[model samples]
Target: MGEPNKIKLGISIGDINGIGCEVALKTFLDNRMLDFCTPIFYASNKTISEQKKRLGLEISFQGIPSAEKAHPGKINVCNVWKENPRIQFGEATEEGGKFAIKSLRAAVNALKKNEIDVLVTAPINKNNIQAEDFKFPGHTDFLAKELGGDSLMFMVSDDLRVGLLTDHVAVKNVANEITTKRVKDKVFTMMNSLKVDFGIRKPKIALLGINPHSGDNGTIGEEDEKIMKPAIASMFDDGHQVYGPYSADSFFGSGNHKNFDAVIAAYHDQGLIPFKTLAFGKGVNFTAGLSKVRTSPDHGTAYEIAGKGMADASSFTEAVFLALKVFKNREEYAELSKNPLKKHQLKKKTKAQ
Candidate 1:
């Protein structure tokens, strides 16, 4: 077992044919990571062994039947499935998606049972992963349903944090989905996440406009003025330090986003396009508002470079690091909130008087 203070990180191997296993194994290769958390990978030994051989990596993993048997100081692989599916690198097959769902479901169950402190999921093929058992658009949606909360797709890095208003929606339908209530809920979620998960006591959030030039006063579109502006006003009236339906075109160009603690964009591409451009290979996709902590790399399954031994593992490693950081921050924030020093401060002031 790891130290009492150490966290237990549960990992779900995404598409078996994707870079999920590659990145997971590569990230755990650094022995120093074990000092902070014990990792339990929800995958079979056969899958992990195949990937290790294909990548020609020297790392070793301990195969266990469940998270309960996971040992510290070693990478643990919990066998979610016994059958070994064909490893087709760079191919999106039904078998690969099936195993990905199996791994994810198993890890999510462990997370719900409190066996794992945090979850770091690898990328999954959104199309092939669809089944009657797993019908959600992506990880964020699936987690929101399973964990019973309105989750926000919050992307984070050292310098920037971006959250989406409407995730995994088509471009044509993005505007219709941007309702006053939706905007308000997303902003509230972002504000709470900034304080509780990131340790920001008072957060300033920026909201992006839904249209070109922010609708140019309705010449291009009116969603920015009609829906977005009112939502910003409502949040402000509620005492949140939120601002702007800023023009997406120049928000990042002028670097105004640096002034705020977080940004909320109207759609997936509106937010993620700039985020990936700024922190593509190192960004972490954090699902805020869930009862449990879950993070994943910002990028998707790289079918082109799945087994080339050239896939960059920076984003995946950063996801794990961010998960650990957020978990610690949440714990500290909880303790600080539970035993506030306001009473003590007042007593000290009385003594001085």
Candidate 2:
């Protein structure tokens, strides 16, 4: 079982055929990582042993029957399966998808039951992992259903946060997906997350335009004027520090993103392109506005360098640090929320005559 004080962190091993296991082992190889939390990997003992040998990593972990037997001050592997998995390094196979789901399901179940305080997921291939039981687009959608709440695809690197209006939707369907309700919900989710997760008092948000020059007054497109503008305006009138239908082309390049607490992009690539370019090898994909704390590395499964020992573990390591930091922040925030401080209006001093 987990120690009374050490936070139990459940790790979901994603895509056995890729670099998930490699990066995970690299992250935990440093003994300093165990000081923050008790790490529990939802994979079998044989699998971990194989990965260690393949990668030539010098580390040892205890094999536990389940998360209930996880111990602090030691790396724990919850052997979800008794048999050894067929690990084809650098290849995507159906077996890879199946066992990935096994690890994910076990970790998620532990997260749901409060057996784990936080969850740090490795990357998974979206194509092969599609099954009838898990028909969602990605982790955000699946976690939203299991954890219950509006999950925002929040990419975080220090103070730079970029949120998505629509995630995993086709380019042709992006415009139709941006409804007033969707905008409002996303804005609220982002706003609330800034306060609760990141500890911002009043969040200043920038909204990215859907078209060139923010529609150029309807010359290029009508989305900015017709849909995005009105929604941002309405939210601003509601006393939220929401601004723009700004041209996304110049926003990040001109360093305008650093001016706000967060930026809301119209779609997945719109936010991710700049975010990954700026924060690559260091960014963390954090799911905001969820009931539970879940985070993953910004990068995906590197099939090309799966077992070649060429994968970098910095992003995965950052994900671990972030999950633990957010867990403590949430606990403190919840306590403060119970008896929040009253908002007081300060009187303006009269000018001396």
Candidate 3:
């Protein structure tokens, strides 16, 4: 185990009944993980221990009172609550949601307070996690409010990067939500993320059509022609490498997404369907354009395979790696930006289109 600048990684145990803890815990069992960052899980030691014992895995971790006490090259469990919630492997209960929120809130507070350098969240059940206090659809919305930036749900892998125009919305409401401002906001957010987070100076961006055959040139639907095209053109004219309203039906199957650095989809499924198809078990959902860096596994809570030891930790592991990578990139970018000449030159080059 090696120390990585003593970077403290804050983790939120997503759903108590899910595979979040299993995969997250499995990822760190490899002592090599300590080479990259120190990790702190925002959950009770008892809760984590119960899951570990249920899965028959041995992990050495110390219980800490808060993120400030996290040790380098060691697993630190921040006890948000001392009492253990009921361990129903596949069942979603109010208790699960309550405790999950407890962990998430604690972790987010730690993140906002700068006690942790970055965050990699575990999977949470969307419906179960919904309540009066935590009424948002998912992490992106919650983080946007907490972190304060135009957020984009960026799905990333070695081969592809996809950002959504709108995520966690209804089909009917999606078209209504796809305004020019939103299209531009999410795309520009992705572009900036590509530059600053992924370290791509010149990133080519693509947009998939909201309608089949890209509205068949106004025959299929007007969203592609009316909404997406103008946004793409505006960004392009502003000196950004933005293009399309390409037919979504054939975009991925025809291998068109490989042509660009990133692709923007009209909605959640439009982006995630192809993304998951091509990179399931390997993709990481990065909440780009936020004040704090947060990433999660592409897949959600695997309730069915919660405790059989069948859950794959690949995506969760990638989330950790990505959170670290982005943190380093942002650090390097910030340092480079300190040079006024370099900063001015970069601004002139990109120019916020």
Candidate 4:
């Protein structure tokens, strides 16, 4: 009954037709993984077993009745559904969709009860999982609704941090959602998460323009000049180190983004296209503004090559590493906020004078 040495990780085994189960097992197979976390897949043992067989991977699976039974060096899975799911390598089915949803819900519930430190969700097929029985655009929207939190899908790689102003929205509708208030809120959320969650203080941020060449002073589009510019100006006055409505075309390569901590992308493709292009299979998708920390690989359920043993685990690893870092640093960040070093330096200087 002593305190468990392992941190319980609630992992949602995303779309079985894709690489979710594959990567989840592979990531857990690293024996050294026990040092950081003990994974509790919110999935049935059958689903994980089938995935391992299809991929021709040799790994052990242990069924645990509850989170308290979880142990390091073994996957402690809480079976979300009792029925055996019909899983095709690259095809979607009703049972598969339902199974994925069940697992996700279980993971979310575990997170709610404090049974897990953080939730590392694998990718899910949004279209397939949106049938009558299952619903959700993706994990971000689903978790946001479940946790009653405003979720911001932010993608991060080595040096790039991109937050979309509008995620999963139609291209035509993106412009309408880019209001000044919305922009300010997302910007502030990203800034706070950067400092508090990611240990980045004095976060320099860049705002992507809603137009070509940042509207060229109201020629291409007035949103940049009218909406984005004023929001950034207001934030600056409020003591934030933010800049731009920089032209999306050339801003990324100009080395300006490298100086800032994160960039707010106007829409899904606007930021993710460039981000994925540069950090594909390397970036981690994090849900900012959630009460609890959540992250996932910055890719989707690759149904085309599902069960082919071809899914890259780099993104998954990065996501796990990021979750651990964020969890551990939360306290450090709070301490830093309570006793800011910059304030102390200014105090010493004043005393000397």
Candidate 5:
């Protein structure tokens, strides 16, 4: 029952005991949000009610059996599970993890069936969300396996966009994971995402080095010169406007990130530390290089502020908006690519041949 041409957004409530429901409810409280998309939350009515009562919120949700029952201008809750798990705010319990996986799996299955146009997920407890059925590092890894694509963890905000070459890996293993093929794949993914998701025709990407001062010209480390520089050179030869192996320490400190359209960091903390530092409450984590659109807030489940009503919903709201924008942009770009002249008027030739 969504409005004509409106996208159907599927939301996966993460870590019931955390601030997932709080931020989600806050983000959807503004009635105007329904104008762009119909949100179908993958959670039970009991869960929503518990969150509302705990947060002292007044927003109401229309309980539905499935995504198809979602109505326009109304927040819909799809009961993925009937069992009402105990809500332990500011605590990570096994029950919380179990319900989080249930919600996420339900939403993901719905997405594969084309029941939702885009997905906006809340935060999850990575450690507790592990079980026999669900065993992955985080959302990106799970989505990569489910959706069958080389997923890139792309953090996006108004000021900067960053993609990770080695995501959710330990620092000791980062260098080994940054192979030539991985670098090329990540950069190519970033390039395509920039074009299709953000509507950038030709994006200039910067690469951050794993070592200090980009290995200080091989005096500090050889990876920057041997691995990173060669990979960048290959990309440039293939007509990509990519540069770097730039020093991570001075890159953000000197504001060199402003020079590029996007950045590719060698590891997670290398990129996220700066991204969160700058756009902590307003960044969106986009899963690039996937067939389906999926995004999440650039933060985790703030257990400490779960029931305190102090969790900021800015990142979650931005994630919703970014997902919608990316979905629309991809659709428009696909149509335009198919019919190059669809939006341009052909000039009449005036020649005496």
Candidate 6:
């Protein structure tokens, strides 16, 4: 009743066979989480009960017919799936894949209708989930397809933030996808996300070089100079503080990444390898350039550690916190834009104006 902050959150249960349900339950067990926001889970009640039992936690779940009934201190399960094909830990099945997809679809619909403030998704298995009915390389792509196009995937943490230009693609095809248009769009998204999602007034960005030692100035490869450099120059011309085409090998070592607010990598491994190596269980996977705020943990569904209770809930918790922060930042940015202020002004006015 304290001012009715009324923050409603939508959580998509990832693969039931994985630890998604376990972490989702554990993360909500903290009454402090309810104090910040009301979590509305898109999963079956049976699955939630099973997961709680599996984790040996006596968490209580309440079924809410709609978001309006959600309250603090109690999780509201929407129950997306009717049939509970209880899956064994660490094992993958078509039913589990379908159930996960159903939850995702329900969450997306709620997002599209503006029923939820933000979405915090758990990790899912890509191979098992990709079928004729459900076809997406990952959650980001699926969310993009559902919400529209032109979304960027950025890993977020307090110290280091990295954005991937191309995600969930084979290494051989990554080079072909790194076109000038893609780079420009991704950079624009990254800068906007930092400003609007993370509340950075003037976001500083570092672009990672695709080759070793930044192509050694055409000695190794010309993609960095030919494709990446021009994109950075164009962004500079527009008056954004973006730098680099730095070698992936030495960028982190130089500590230059710490200087910038975010780093843009050329491909999946080029960005994630450094981010995960540094972030480990701390980073949150934030999908930028979307109409709605969405975040997930940086790591995947660890089938190996699935029922062992070894899966750390820290990253998943961070994902929830970051998603809420992004949602709040977006609201703040919108308010500021409607009544433009002089505290911070860009040389080139935003299209939002």
Q: What is the number of backbone collisions in each predicted candidate, taken in the order shown?
A: 0, 1, 0, 0, 0, 0
lDDT of candidates 1 onward, in order: 0.90, 0.89, 0.91, 0.83, 0.91, 0.85
Indicate the TM-score of model 1. Answer: 0.95
TM-scores of all predicted structures: 0.95, 0.95, 0.95, 0.93, 0.96, 0.94
Candidate 2 per-residue lDDT over residues 162-236, each given as its tens digit? 999999999999999998888889999999998878867679999999987899999998888899989999999
Which runs of model 6 end up more than 4 angstroms from their true locations? 1-5, 341-353
Q: For candidate 4, write residues 217-316 as lDDT tens digits.
A: 9999789988999999999999999899888988777767787899998989889888988899889999998888899998888889888898888899
Instruction: Report the alpha-carbon TM-score of model 6 versus the true structure.
Output: 0.94
Model 6 per-residue lDDT at 246? 83
lDDT of 4 at 313: 88
Clashing pairs in 4: none
The C-alpha local distance difference test score for the whole of candidate 1 amounts to 0.90
Cα lDDT over the full model 4: 0.83
Candidate 3 segments whose C-alpha is farther than 4 A from its true place? 1-4, 340-353
Query: What is the model-wide C-alpha lDDT for candidate 2?
Result: 0.89
lDDT of 6 by residue, 1-353 (tens): 31246578899988988888877778877877887888899987787877877788877878876666665667889877678777788888877788888888898898898888889998898988888877789999999988885899999888999999899999999888899999999998988888888777788898998888889899998898899999899889899898988888888877889899999999999888888998988999999999888999888878888877777899999998998888888887787787656324542354346
Error of 1 at 214 (Å): 1.2
Clashes of 5: 0
Better of 2 and 3 by lDDT: 3
Error of 2 at 75 (Å): 0.6
For model 3, residues 301-335, the per-residue Cα lDDT tens digits are 87888888999999999999999999999987898
